[model samples]
Target: MSRTPSFEPYEGPAGGWGSARSLGNILRREGVPASGTLVLGRQNKVDGFQCVSCAWVKPAKPLPFEFCENGAKATAWEITSHRCEPAFFAKHTVSELLGWDDYHLEQVGRLTHPMRYDAASDKYVPVSWGKAVREIGQTLRALPDRRNVVFYSSGRTSNEASYLYGLFARLYGNNNLPDSSNMCHETTSVALPPAIGVPVGTVALDDFAKTDCILFFGQNPGSNSPRMLHPMQEAAERGVPIIAYNPLRERGLERFTNPQSPTEMLTHHETKLASQYHQVKAGGDLAALTGICLAVLEMEDHAKQARLPPVLDHDFIDTHTHGFGDFLGWLRTQGWAELERRSGLSRSAMTATAEVYARSKATIGIYGMGLTQHRAGVETVQMLVNLLLMRGNIGRDGAGICPVRGHSNVQGQRTVGITEKPELVPMDRLAKQYGFEPPRETGLNTVEACEKILAREVPAFIMLGGNFVRAIPDRGQMEPAWREIGLTVNIATKLNRSQLVPGRISYILPVLGRIEQDVQNGPQSTSMEDSTGCIHGSRGVRKPASPHLISETRLVCEIAEATLESNPLTPWKDWASDYRLIRKSIGETYPEIFFDYDQRMWEPGGFQRPLPARHREWKTENGKANFITPKGLAEDKDMPEPDEDALRLITLRSNDQFNTTVYGYTDRFRGIRGTRDVVLMNRSDIARLGLSEGDRIGLRTASKRDDVRRELGGLTVVPYDIPAGCIGAYYPEANVLLPIWHYAEGSKTPAAKSVPVHVYRGPAAA
Candidate 1:
């Protein structure tokens, strides 16, 4: 077991010691840091694999060190020399492994071969590819109602793998294709397309250099996407104003020391990131952003009265947008008093933010899960877009909307049709091109999938990649519900906790990681779509960890072949042999964007998928950009009043961890070390609750649903720079306190960042 680390106040910038420690962790695990550098250096390059970390856009000109701390760690973790053979599993049973934490279980090593759970032996045993696939195929083929099976995709799977996976699921029967995006960016996907007619972000990475201002709403690029720090630093040096809107004062947005700069490395210098920071209350971004828009309107009226040029973009509104009059009418009716109360910020701050937006000719807005994982997540995303549309920021240099994606290919997965709703992709095209009738109905999302499993409606669960149970809320219900499934299949590199909690029958299919080469078509190349809508080729550099491992592309094809009994009509074997064939099929599927797929991906910077909004050509129902005018702020009127002792809970990630993947129990940026069981609160709240900084406290959640007691016990309190009524804790740990139904209304994403709870000085639970 790993020893608990010690904590100290981390006063240094983000990329110094914390970065060094991340690389050192790989060295300690591999006994040498030199081995992974060559592979890491090639990340996000022309002939290299995509970074298996966050989905920040790669620079047009590749940096010398394109990989960040977490990117390197993912490499080191995947390319380690150690192995988890069948003998290892024979020694330790699934029950025994379940007792270990996520870090300890993954650190055991990678699975070397396909394995199946042996009920009598109470351990996993090695099984050949042929037998395992055949058995699984037989079971699936025997099913009476095919909708009982659900396929889950992850962000790490390449585009070719994802396209084939989606096609297979639809052809087989149901459109029950849930992906990691369901839990992360489903709000962005659902909200953007209606207003702008495209779900992808409109901004390119190159836009960072020329934007006059940047408004960051609920995102922390310094920790989540470290590569973003370089461009942000450049923009900062260029005197581009940056405005930050968040509930807590994130260390990332405060400042950054670019590790790549020689002067900063030598002199320990830092670059200021956020020029203006406002701590918007929890679930208060909708009100705050609306206030900014209101301020812009007020500025325009004042300019008109003074006989100055109009602040609004009349040409863009007249030519490329709709709903302006209605939006203007609603803006006039808004109450500034209620907005101030809901936003937790004075009118001065909101007006100041609006001045920055109005004066700047072009601005790029970047956001993260902070705005999306809420009761009105879709509203907040659309509102941010509405603010940009007023100034005609959509189709200009250094101006557009950017939602920093969490996974490397979360956007790509959606691009290639890994969605539960297949209506987004034309069914006629799929049917005509693939020679199969595809399912047209909407299917279960991540939340609905869990609910189906709980109700015993879904019998089989096949995961392409991901830590399923660990990333969701209501873990107490999800864990037991997973076992009710008839079969569970996992395709993964590392041994995650999800594999331990299995259905009645389970199988573990070892697959090649992105850094590992696939020899099926003589070093096959995979493609991915970055956050900026750029599609690039990604070819693995390292050899497979074990010879038994198969590529995800080939594995999906084999399963389909086995289940369908080798259909002559389907070109599964041909497509599996050469990935270019799959690319050809993908081009035919989405001709407008993916035309000449194999050749276009070979370009040095890769090709960007055509964005209609980027050219100021809105493809909405009215064929113009929309100005969404809601009835008013729903969260403001509908949000229940918290008790005097209640605190609004915001779940966060430690700097040392990824989504559900714990690199270590240390958040060095936050001065958190040695433990994940701690709560961050304001000093005033600690005093009000009669608790000390290191006091062990119990948090009882305030929920309107579910009668079960929801509490987290024995948490150490740490003083943080945040609003008094708000508190923070690491997610998945606090996920247990959430009721299953506490999610966004339209998107169905769990409202992980905003939960109502109260801290008490009482007996600890754990």
Candidate 2:
């Protein structure tokens, strides 16, 4: 357990000495001090493994130390000297390990061998790979309906492995493939295709160089993607205006001092990032964005009256888009007073931001989960698209919609057919090439899968690389439901909370990490797609943590081989032994996208998958970009106005964490030390709630449903510079308060950002 946390204001910039010191401390703690630098030196290089962190775009020209603090921690965490062997499990039972925190569980180090749960002893025992695969195959084969099985993939998986995993699920007769994207950027994938003709971001790494302005929304680059700060700093230094709109003023958007810069490091000089920062209310992004567009239209109308040049891009709208007149008509109907009340921003600020967008020749719109993890996630993204469409930002150099994805290959996983919706991929081609009937019926997504599991409908669950139990919402209900499932299989490198909450029959299959060499056929390489739509090869340099570990591809192929009847056309053995064969098959599957896959992936910066949106070609039903209008300003149309006692909860990650993996107890950027169980509230809200800083508070979900009681207690209150009526808490801990049924309407992403809750003094409060 961690010590009690202490709060203080962070006075320094985002990076520089603080980041460097943090990295050094993590290395020393992981017992890789000297060798860690050597490992990090190879990260993100052409001939090296990709960083297993955020899917930030890698530059065409590389730097010597391209890895950031989070990347280094991920690498060190994977390459740690400590090991979780069979002997360790012999001493501690699953129930005992369940009491350990997430950080301590992962800190126990990498799993050395495949293990099977012995329910009698409540402990895991080492199992032979052959026996484990055979038994798992028997269980899967015994299932009455293939749709009852769920195959979940993580963003850390490579494209090749993800493709095989998807193919295996389909061949076994279902498309129930729910990946990490379902929880994060599914909104972007579902919303962008209709507007931009692509599911991924349109901008490349080089776009930042030519962009004259940047519109940043809801993403904190300092903790989530540190490497993004380097380019942001460069753009800041080049006089490019960066407009940031978020509920909290993140340190990364405020100012930054690049740790790689010697002069700045020595002088302690900081570069201001966001020229203008607007702290919009949580769940108010739709209203805020609508206000900006309305302000832009007002500016255009005023320009016409003054006989000045038109503010709208008439040529682009006339030539390549539809529904403009309707959009214009709706903008005129919106009232400014309502917009201000909902958005928590004054009209002058909206108009000023509109002026910035109208004056700049090119502007890139960037956003993250803050806009996605809401009830109006899809609409919010479409509104961002609406803003870009007005200015002809799509399909233009240095200007486009960029969704900063979380996991490294999340976008890549979708690209490789890891989706619950079969129509998203070329199912006919896959059926023809592999000689198997593909499942045409839509499959369950992450939330839907959980619903089925809770209903006792799911028979088996196979996880590729994530802590599913911990990552999902409504954990109090899900954990017990997860244990009730017939079988659960986890393929991972380290021990996580998901593994401890085992099913009736469970197996923990240890796999090689990204930094470990896979020697299936003399050494193998895997490909991953970055957030910018670039496909590159990653070859692991270090040896496996244990000789007992196997490659993810091999493990997936072996399971497929054991479960399904042998097919001459599939040739699972060939693909398992040589990844090039898998690439060749993928090339055949997506000839237009992955042509000459093996050879091109080895190029200096690899190659970019073609994005039709980048070339002014819309793949919509009418072959033109369409303007989408959201129904209302409130993200959740059904959400009743909160009472005076209610506050909107926004779940966020700390600097010492990535997704659900906790590295330590310190949130360096927020000046939170030694604890993760705390709530950041506006000073006014704190006072209004009759609470002071350091007061222990309890929060209960303000849900209409009466069946479940979701509450978190003993949380220390820390006054923060956030908007009133909004409070922030760390995710996974706060995920319990998010109702499982409350999610985005179209995308089905859990509405974690705008959960309504009531706060009060805890029993321990003085």
Please provide TM-scores, in order, for all candidate models, with all chains considered together: 0.97, 0.99
lDDT (0 to 1) per candidate: 0.85, 0.91
Off by more than 4 A, model 2: 763-766
Q: Pick the candidate with the highest TM-score.
A: 2
lDDT of 1 by residue, 469-563 (tens): 77888777778888878999999888988999988889999999988888885669999888899988988899788999998899999999888
Off by over 4 Å in 1: 2-5, 636-639, 761-766
| TM-score, cand. 2 | 0.99
Residue pairs that clash (backbone atoms under 3 angstroms), model 1: 5-674
Writing each residue's lDDT as its tens digit, candidate 2 over 19-52 gives 9999999999989998888989889999999989
Worst 10 residues of 2 by lDDT: 757-766
